[model samples]
Target chain A: MAPLIEVADLRTHFFTDEGVVKAVDGVAFTIPAGKTVCVVGESGSGKSITGRSILNMVPYPGRVLDGAIRWQPDGAPPVDLLALDPKGREIRAIRGKDIALISQEPMAALSPVHTIGNQMIETIRLHLGLTKADARARAAEMLAKVGIPRPKDRLDSYAFELSGGMRQRVCIALAVACGPKLLIADEPTTALDVTTQANILDLFRELRDALGVSILFITHDLGVVAEIADEVVVMYLGQVVEQGRVDDIFHRPLHPYTRALLGSVPRLTRHRPERLPTISGMVPSPFERPSGCLFHPRCDRFEQGLCDRSAPELDRYANDRVARCFKAGAGS
Target chain B: MLTYILRRILFMVPVTLAISLVAFIIIQLPPGDFITALTAQMAENNETLDPETLAALRDRYGFDQPMIVQYWKWITGIVFRGDFGQSFEWSRPVADLIWDRLGLTLIVSFATLVFVWVLAFPIGIYSAVRQYSWGDYIATFFGFIGLAVPNFLLALVLMYLSSRYLGASVGGLFSAEYVNADWSWGRVVDLLNHLWVPVIVLGTGGTAALIRIMRANLLDELKKPYVELARARGLSETRLLLKYPVRVALNPFISTLGWILPTLVSGAVVTAIVLSLPTSGPLLLNALFAQDMYLAGGFILLLSILTLIGTLVSDLLLAWLDPRIRYE
Candidate 1:
């Protein structure tokens, strides 16, 4: 099936006093229908920005300068989100009904003063055009579906009153209340405890299985990526360095940055290295991204002359994978 | 919740007593009692204070007793009999004096409070939502100007301009004909007509400060993840703003009610004198200057009661509005 959403050559830049920071510079990916695509990147890799760009909310002082976000609804012509005005009515219709988001911080993702029921019902009423009673019923139903106990009572509880896990569950419930086509879960489990994280992940898979919603999962945790992702896209310094199926990316990471990321993960069933390997050098500040290949400065397989002089295109690897490097999938 | 309120009320008794005691001590801090002030006035007018008359007056007012005994008598009289004592200057009951002027003072304070919130709310929200826009800049500029101008100076300027250009007497609460007139629709209108001058003068600083505060608080709230989540939920910018960030922002503003009442009343003193308005502010000032102990103490005690009640009301309101505070 065609991808539910296809992002092409997207560039989101933040204009600040220091300089222009190309937060998501020419990065692209897609969320296939009914599948979870995890975009893994460390801090400042533009993973969150990529998720936000799909909703056309890059925030103030930042603009999506060039890109095409073609959202393909079932049996309908693909809508180019980049073409729609960010503040206009058409985008508003697409935002909650078609594409909803579950943010990372559960505590900060819900209004402290408003009850969970009010927030959920208002969104439902606005988009689904349901009456207040119907919206409340739907919200309670969604809450129960997300595994919240005493759904009716939970509705009246404020965000701060709920535990971190419970709050994330409510957030999930609210996001999928309207049966959105795509859910952008930006590190939805990062702030949660390990047990709660597993439970939330299971809930996401169930939601996908039941509702057939496509999910664009953004995170830096390789463990989470391994657990949930059908496909994986590795990002570095605001650019996509590798893209492929999760098994392929994990077992056969081609880009130097991707390989380094995989190497940094702790493993069992083997002798442990005395010092855990990490990707050398910090993420370059957005205002001062390196020329040529952005990751060459920290690449373990850095070529003295070639890797430093010109940027390599994302060329094909075996089994329909892509990587940006002079020597793709050679060493291991 | 009932227990919490009951506990708070119980806690307020000692606090109020302490405040009243301090008010009494401060009233007594000046050189001598009302008798001294009376004698000085008589001396200034070159009239001798006859020794027999002085002794008789001292005995009658219990000035011949020890300071502690006099304080005990005063406290007992107020607590048991609800007597705020006699205003030596006006030779009337202090309660009657405060009661007569309390209505006008409350009207002015209440009007100023409403004016502050009404003007600040929308402007503050606009400044925050459209921060760095021209509207924000203009609102900020005017806010700073309002903060910088003294309330008394503003009162004088407004008084002069209105009297000069409009040929209207905007000084007192009522017109010359309605000054001592009985209640009537015409008198009420005249009172309202002159009410705006003091209200505007007193409200300008608070309105400006509140706008800045509201803008800052909402700006902080607007950056929270909930706001973005709301936006992503496709909540229209207006509804999303009002429902989430503005609601959170209002907490700090509401909590200021306690401080606001006292600040407005105290700040009104100079402006009241400047505009020649017949409010409690001018009466309190004169009482303090003349060492009219009962009148001064009465005014202070009333203000203290208002302060305590304002705090309780704000706390209750905050609990009602915010669930986190309510449960806590």
Candidate 2:
């Protein structure tokens, strides 16, 4: 079957006064139906921007300069999201109905002044074309589905009235309320506590199984990727470096950057290192991006001449895996 | 909320009392009482009053009483019988003089308030949403000009332009013929015709300031995460803006209501003088200048009460609009 959504050569750039910032530079990934694809990267790696670009909600001064986001719903014809007007009705109809987004900061995601029910009902009524009473009923049902107790009373409560964990649950309930086919959760659990994070991840897995929804979960936590993701796409400096089954990427990371990322994860061994192993250099500033490989400056196994002289294409490998490196398939 | 409102209202009692005391003291701070001011004017006109008649005048007006006694009598009269004492300049009751102008004063003040709101709200929203656009630039330019130019100067310039180019008689809420006429449709129409001058002149500065405030406030709100989240919910641009950011941005507008009541009675005093409008502002100014303590003090006390009431109304409105605000 065709993938639920396919992103190819996506290049989202910001036109600032100083220079152009290629935030999501030539990135590609696919989210299959009823599966979770975790896009893992550090801050500014453009994972969030890539997610936003799929919804055509990139903020001002930024544009998807070159890309094709082909969205194929279960029974609907395929449509390239980029071809539609950003503010047009067609894209708007798709945004909350077919695809939904949840952000990291739940406190900021929900409006402080509006009741949770009011916001939920608004989205429900808009997308579902239900009357006020029906939408409200649906909203309460959604709150209950997301494990919020006393869902009827909680609907009237303001965002500030809820705890951080409850607020994120509210966000999740809001995103899945419309029965969207694809949900782009941008670091949804990053701001949560460990226990709450586990609960939320469990909720995500339950929702995916129950609703048969595809998830593009963006995060920097490798453990979270392991817990939730079926497939892993590792990104560095706005480009996807390696992508395969989560186990494959974890056990046999093809790209040097991916190997370094996996190496940095703390282990449960008896011996403890004084300092956790870390990738050497900083992610280069967009304006001062080095020629050839963007990750060469930070890669420990950096080839002095070749890695600096020419960029490596994302090369395909056996067992349905891909890595962007000159030494792909070579021993780590 | 009811308890909160009751508490606020109860709190206003002491506040009103303190304000009345301050107003009386400030009115009295200018050297001499009404009798002395009358004597000074008489001396200026080269007409000397006999000592016996002067003593008799002082006795009749109770000017010979101690300061505390006078204040007590004034407060008791106002509280019990709604009397604001006697205006020394007009030789009439202060209540009578103020009541005559209060109607027109309220009319002009309310009209100016409406005018400022009607002009500022949409323009402010536009300027913020379309920041740096040509429309925003034009509004910002006009807003700055309105802020920089004094109301009296603007009034004078508009008066000149209207009389010179529009060929209309300038100033006052009524034409000469209707100045002393009884209430009639013709008089009401005449009042309406002359109302715009003061309304625009008074509203310009307020409108300008409110526009800037609204723009800045909305700009900040538009950048907030909820606004983007609302957009992601598939709401159209206009609906998303009005429902989220604009609702949040209206706090300042509602808070401005607290000052509107006092401004209704005393705002644009200089402009009222320049235009020769028979509003309470000019009446208060003249009373102050001539040392008509009763008249000036009455105006101040009325304004203070109005301010307290206005503040209460604004607080209630703000609580109603924003769910997060709890009146404790």
Best by lDDT: 2
Candidate 1, true inter-chain contacts retained: 0.82
Model 1 lDDT, residue B147, Cα: 99
Each candidate's fnat = 0.82, 0.65
lDDT of 2: 0.90
CAPRI-style grade of the A/B interface in model 2 = medium
- TM-scores of all candidate predictions against the true structure: 0.97, 0.97
| Model 1 residue B149 CA deviation in Å | 1.4
Q: Candidate 1's residue-wise lDDT over A1-332, tens digit each? A: 78888999999999998999888988877778999999999999999999999999998799999999998888479889989988889999988889999999998999988899999999999899999999999999999999999999999988888899999999999999999999999999999999999999999999999999999999999999999999999998888999999999988888888888988888775476667778899988787778789998898788888888899888888887888888888878
Instruction: State the local distance difference test value for candidate 1.
Output: 0.90
lDDT of 1 by residue, B1-328 (tens): 9999999899888998898889988888878887888898889999988889888988988877876687788778889999999988999999999986877887888888899999999999999999999999999999999999999999989989999999997888888999889889998899889999989999999999999999999999999999999999998888888888999899877898888667866877888888888888889988988888889988888888888988999999999988889987
